[model samples]
Target: MKLSLAEQMREMDKKAIEHGIPDIVLMENASIKSFYQILDAYGDVSGSLAVCFVGAGNNGGDALAIARHLYNNYCDVFIYMLVPEEKLNPSPKTNFEIIKNMGIPYKFVENDDDFDIEVINEADLIIDGIFGTGLSRKVEGRFKKAIELINDSDAFVVSVDIPSGIKADSGEVMGIAVEADLTPTFALAKPGHFLYPGRIYAKDVRVVDISTPVSVIEEFDPSFVAIDSSQIKLTYRNPTSHKGDFGHLAVVGGSTGKSGAVIMASKAALKSGVGLVSAVIPASINTAFESHLLEAMSYPVDDNGGFFSENSIDSILEFVADKSAVCLGMGLGVTESTKKVVKAVMGIEKPMIIDADGLNCLSFFVDELKNRKAPTIITPHPKEFSRLCGVKTKEVLEKRLELIKEFATNYNCIVVLKMADTLIASPDGKIYINTTGNVGLATGGSGDVLSGMIGAFLAEGYEPLQAAINGVYLHGLAADIATESSISYESLMPSDVIENINKAILSFFEA
Candidate 1:
């Protein structure tokens, strides 16, 4: 599903209201769905204490409406309004009046002391409605205190819309944010719900239909998509097709001690259905490559001190002359000579997937990518991207979406920014966030596997953009599948991910 920005969601809400869906009705639907989700989690809410922290905005209105429902369902509901009743927004004020008429227990928590620790201690569930998606600044004062209290509590938290104090666009925490066990968001999920700090805060997010019509959402034509197998374009093989039909991919890199990088990459390419795959590595590692990779062919490049030197570029070009795609930069030491080789390959005019030291070396010659003959795809984790952008890691993360878009658009290439939520930014301004995979993929050599998979897809004739998107989604899906059979995240290695490639591909077709 396409994730909406905060403004896009507000616009969706407005459009729903304009089309005769009452604001109160949307609030009712959201609260009712949340009530059911609570029931699903806790079995029953009758006589169970639920403390709701309400603010002064429309989100507060959601809390007030929900408070009425919880009371009706026989739950002991306690409403803690962050602002006075008179200061509430019109919708919240309306709901406040209704809840007031119902004689629900409520308090105006306008100060630090009003954030009662005892109340939180007695609650089975906490409803966080202190802030909404429009929140821009850092949380402060009484709200921050309340958020701290919520986080410190042992009770299950259900955040309405988004967790309070989470920046909806970037998923950045605003000083403090509620740690929610479940977040029943209205209409569409926001970027914050999936991005880190925010993803951690919103543990289990469930998107509830609040009667917003599909026509309204499609009007925005959201370009941001959450990656899923359905988006992967898997080309079925014809019975008459030969081995050469799928195209050959050249894997380059693997220095003296890092031969395993190219080996993993080459094997992964073969696993990804590349018709012919070869590893172009330093001749010194030929024995290592030959021993580990039985299905893939190997091309030995002249090695200078056990690493590809400037002289290796000629051998690489000649070797890849007939190859459809090239993957460079796994385990290639960031030596000056190796950088020369990488820079030379950039001008070869083939679909190239660059990673690890390839990305590190390219960081020095980023402008060279624009002059390349064919499309380029770069896979960079946050630290590598930060080095390429010449920004601090935190700054790179804070502006990930912006930086990746700028880099891809400016260089006219595709970027797969590896993060907790892997984002594929295309030159055409489209962004895809990968939702599969787990912490199990946090080990080394995973990026090499990803680059190889992407190269294989490109070799198999997927567009540069689709190749990157498919490769990232499949890479994560493989790890996810690998971990499902008792292979803990700590024990799951990149080779394990490679082992599950076929299963992941078959699952894609099955899905």
Candidate 2:
């Protein structure tokens, strides 16, 4: 399903209403789904206490409707309205009056002084409806205290739509947010439910269908997506095709102490189905790579102070002649000679995966990217991205989507911003979020493995963007598989991920 921002979802809801689905009907459906989800979570509600913190908007109306359902089912329900009954929105006020007529007790608490903490503590389940996706301002006053009370309580919190205080568009916390055990979002999942601090707050999220027609969602056409296995495509190879037909790949970079980076990347490229893999390293340590990389061909490049020298560019260019794609800058340190070498490599028109020290090198020559003719793919973790953009780390993290989009559009390059939730931004304005991966991928050399895998895909004739998306997904899937085998995310190493590449590929096809 296409993951959306607040604006896109609001537009979809508006379109649904315009197409004959009434606002009241959607509310009723939302209440019904939330009721069942609560029942499914806590079994019978015969005499349990359900305290619903209602707001002044449609979200509050949802809680009021849900409260009525709980009251009808013989559960003791209390309504804590944050606004006056007469000040509520039309639909919510209507539901409020109905609940009052039905004899369900409610208290209007506009500030902390009016709220009773003891009453909140007695609840078996708390439904947070204080705010939804439309919340923009920082939460304060009575609403803030109410969220604090709900969180402090031992009750199982079920947030309606989204956890209060999370920005729906960016997944950023607005001051503070309620940590929910279950969030039954209406119609579709928002970016907040999956992005970092917000994702941490929203423990378990389940998308609830509220009768919005599938046609409306399709018509909206949200460009952002969380990739699933169904979208992965590995074309059938010709039965008569030979090793030479699959394409050759080259991995460059690896200084004095960091020769293992290129070795790992080369091994990963070979494991990713590249027909022939070549490892290019410093001449002094060429024997080291040769001994370890039994299947991969090794070439010696000139070096100064254990790093690639500017003079080696000619040899590197010569070596890349027969290669279809190249993965560069794994551990090549940021020295003067290495900078010149990187400049020469970037001048090549071959599809290249620039990563690690390569990204550091590119930061110095970002302006050169506008003049490049080839499709350049740079894989940078948050810090590396920060350096490349010449911004603070916090700025990069806070405005990731915007910065990535602008960089890709301006540079005309495919960018892989590696984070907990990896984002793939294309030059043409498409964005993809990887749905597979675990904490096990947090180890060293994991990014190096990913660079090699993407380079291998580029060699195998995949488009630059698709190559990045597939490589990232498969890399994470391999880590997830490794975690499954060991039943631990901590024990899985980069090599373990490489070992499971075949299994990950098979699983993708099976899926």
**TM-score of every candidate:** 0.95, 0.94
Off by over 4 Å in 2: 236-238
Clashing pairs in 2: none
List model 1 lDDT by residue over 1-511, tens digit each: 7789988888888889999998888888888888788788766888889999999888889988877888898999998989887788888888989988889988888689987799898899889989998899999999999999998999988898899989998889989899989888888888888877788888778888878987887776675787766688898889999988998999989999999999999989999999999888999999999998899999998999999978878878888878898899999999999999988887787889999999899999888888987988999999999988899999987789999999999989898999879998988887888888899898898988998999999999999888988899889999999999979999999999999999999985675
RMSD of each: 1.8, 2.1
Local error of candidate 1 at residue 56 (angstroms):
0.9
Clashes of each: 0, 0
In terms of lDDT, model 2 sits at 0.87
Off by over 4 Å in 1: none
Rate residue 282 of model 2 by lDDT: 84
Tell me the tens digit of each residue's lDDT in model 2 across 1-511. Answer: 5788888887888888998998888888999999899888777987999999999878899999999999999999998999888878888888898998999999989678887788889999898988989999999999899999988999989898889999887778999899999888888888788777788888778888899988887666666776668557677778999888777888889998888898889989889888888888888778878888899998888888889988888999888967888898998889998888888888888888999998898899888888888788989999999999999999999899999988999999999999988988888876777878888888889999999999999888888888897899999888888888765787878889899998999875675
Best by lDDT: 1
Give residue 55's lDDT in candidate 2 (0 to 100). 90
Worst 10 residues of 2 by lDDT: 222-231
